[model samples]
Structure formats: structure tokens, C-alpha cells
Target: MPRLLIAEDDADLGPAMKRALELDGYVVDLFARGDDVLVAVGVGSYDVILLDIGLPHMTGLEVLRALRARRDETPVIVITAFDRTPHRVAGLDAGADDYVVKPVDLEELAARIRSQLRRRERRHDDSLSVGRVTLDFAGHVASMDGEEVLLTAKEFRVLALLMRRSRRFVSKTDLEGELYDQDQWVESNTIEVAISSLRRKFGRDFIRTARGLGYMVGGLEA
Candidate 1:
């Protein structure tokens, strides 16, 4: 099972999030203090770390800075109730993979977690590209027509998965878990909907569907 570290100060919310993620099949370690988090991170094999901005002993931002200073590339996502642009900017610049302003919807938070994990996986892949779409695994971004195509968090993840294995069918269930919690109960068409939306944002020809299989993004009909 995947391991996750949740650094949250709220007595109630922290455990709440842990319970939710644990039932989703992740082995979660919850910490209410930043100093403890720092210590634990240095010694633990964490696949994902869900951090809150407010923390005792050390600020969450301080912990994040400390982790990045040591070149820890483990995905750290800041989940805070504060929705300020300056704070968000600081978190990303400090090496956070993503941020969520609370009170978070459990389903959405799970989706964000799935997206970050998949994104990290894509980084270690050799390379990903299809048609005009060029994905830089090292740089962690996608491009088309020589322009950096702006993609939402979910869009980038979904596109990366398909482009990494171009000409292959990706089933909805395969995508479902990677984009949501196991108990989040997304509709079967959730993958289809997300893909359809992405197709419109990009170009319809960019993604192809194989009736009973799933979706593919790459190459031409020829």
C-alpha cells in the first residue's frame, strides 16, 4: 500500500482526513506538529505528504522549506483554509506540488492526491509525446504547437498517462482510482467527461476513444 504523511494541526480535521485517506487504501501517518513532521519525513518512506499551513513547534512553511532545502522531491501538497495568493505563491515556490484551500471536499482532496502521485510517476518515465503534444517528463509540463499548453492539474495528469503509452487504451477504472479515492464513488463516465472536456480545451483530434476499451491520446486516424 502507498504511504502518506498528513501534517495537520487541527485536532479534529487532521484525524478526519487521515481516516478518509486510510479507508481509501493508503497507510497514513498523521502529525499535528511541524517539527515532528520534519523529523519523521527525514526518516520515513512517504509517497505523499499532505501538509497544513498552520503548525506548532515549527510552521508548516518552515517544514516545507527544510524538506526542499535537503532536496526531498517527495510530493508535498499544502491544504489550508487560508486562500491568499501570496501564501499560495510562497508554498509553490517552496517546492509544494499543489495546494488546496479548505474546508476541502474529501472527494476533491482524494482526486488531488491521486493526480499528484500520478504526476510524480510520469516524471520517471522515459519521455511522453504524441502528435503535436510534447510532454517533458523532467520538466513536468506538456506542450503543443511549440507553445506550453496550460492544463489544469487533472488535465496534465490524464494527458501524461495516455501520452506516455501512446496508441494504448486506458480503461476508466484504471483512470478512476488514480483520479479519485476508492470510496469517492465517481460515476463510470467520470473519465469520459474529463477526457471530453480536455479534448475541447485542446483539440478533438488529440484524443481517441475505442468504444468498449477506454481513451487514447496520440497519433492520427491513419
Candidate 2:
């Protein structure tokens, strides 16, 4: 999991922000002062930063500019008390991703964090390796046991989605949505056929059936 730095100067809001992000599965580091944030940012590899524009020593804008000057690409969402037009624009210009005004909903803040992390995930697809199975999306290949297991396009798409979100049970409907036209008349068991095909081409144990729940695709260790 990626870490988040919550740099809020307000005494009450800072701990609240920390609790919200921590509940959402992020390892959070809190800094009540802007000067403290400068030291915190250098100490850790933060995936996203929630910065308050109004601060004691360094304003959020100055910190953002300083970070960008050092070529830091960590996504910074300016969580500011300032609702002025110039503040928002200046934050964006200073390399902030989005600006959230004060008195914000923690759920929406968490959603924004998730959106940024997902964008970063898609940007870097070095490869998805699970146990002995590997899904090379760019090369359009699935290899196991040091050999290419020839797969159809639909098989690849189904496998890719599962591999991307491996360890979770992907429902039949979700996989169907990924494989076919939404408006088209496809059989209810179309996904079953695809799953069966993938299992045959790869290995019988490649994807596990969860009875009525859905399909679990990947090794247990993966």
C-alpha cells in the first residue's frame, strides 16, 4: 500500500484527515506545520499528498513549487481553506493534481485519492506476474512453464482483468461486461465458456470456481 502525507495545520482537521485516509488502507504520516512537511516529504516515498494551502512557515503553494522544482511527480491534492479563484489556479499551475476546498467530505477525498492511484497504476504496466503465470499485456502473451500458452483475444481480456485484480472473486456479470457488447444478446453462460476455455488453454487450476459467488483467477500465493 502507498503512504499519504496529511499536512493540515488545523489541530482538529489534521487528526480527522489522518483517520479518514488510514481507514481507507493508506499508511498516513501527519504533519501539523508546513515546515514539518518539508522534512516529512524527503523522509518517505509518498504516493499522494493532501496539503493544506494555509500553513505557518511554508504555504502549500511554496511547498508544491519546491517539490516540482526538485522534479517530484508525487500527486499532490491541495486541500485548502482558501476558496479563492487564484489559489486554485495557482495550485494547479504549481503542479498540484486537484484542489479540494475546506469543509470537504472525507469519502470524496478518499475517492480522489483512489482515482489518482488507479491512474498511476495504469500508467506503469511493467508486467503482472502471479506464481508461475505471467500476463504480458503489451506483448499479448500468457506464459507458464517457460512456454507461451496461446490464448484468444477474449481469453486475454478476461485473464488480463482478473490478473490486474487478482486475489479477488470477479463475478460472472463483470467478466461478461469485459468480454462482449453490452447491448448484444449473449448467453448467460458465455463467461462460463470463456473461463472453461482459459482453463483448458492454460491449466485446469489456473482459475478456481467459487460455486455461486464468481470466479477466482490466479494462484493462491499470487
lDDT of 2 by residue, 1-222 (tens): 878898888989999989878887889998877878877765445778999988789888889888776555678999987898998889999999988998978989998999888876775375565557787778888898668888878777888877765546788888888867533666787777888998887778878778676877543323
lDDT of 1: 0.79
Model 1 per-residue lDDT tens digits across residues 96-203 = 999999997899999999998898677647455455667776776777767887776666777777765455668877777667743456676767777987888778
Number of the top TM-score candidate: 1
Clashing pairs in 1: none
> lDDT per model, in order?
0.79, 0.79
Q: Which residue ranges in model 2 land beyond 4 Å of their true spot?
A: 126-222
Distance from true location, Cα of 61 in model 2, Å:
0.5
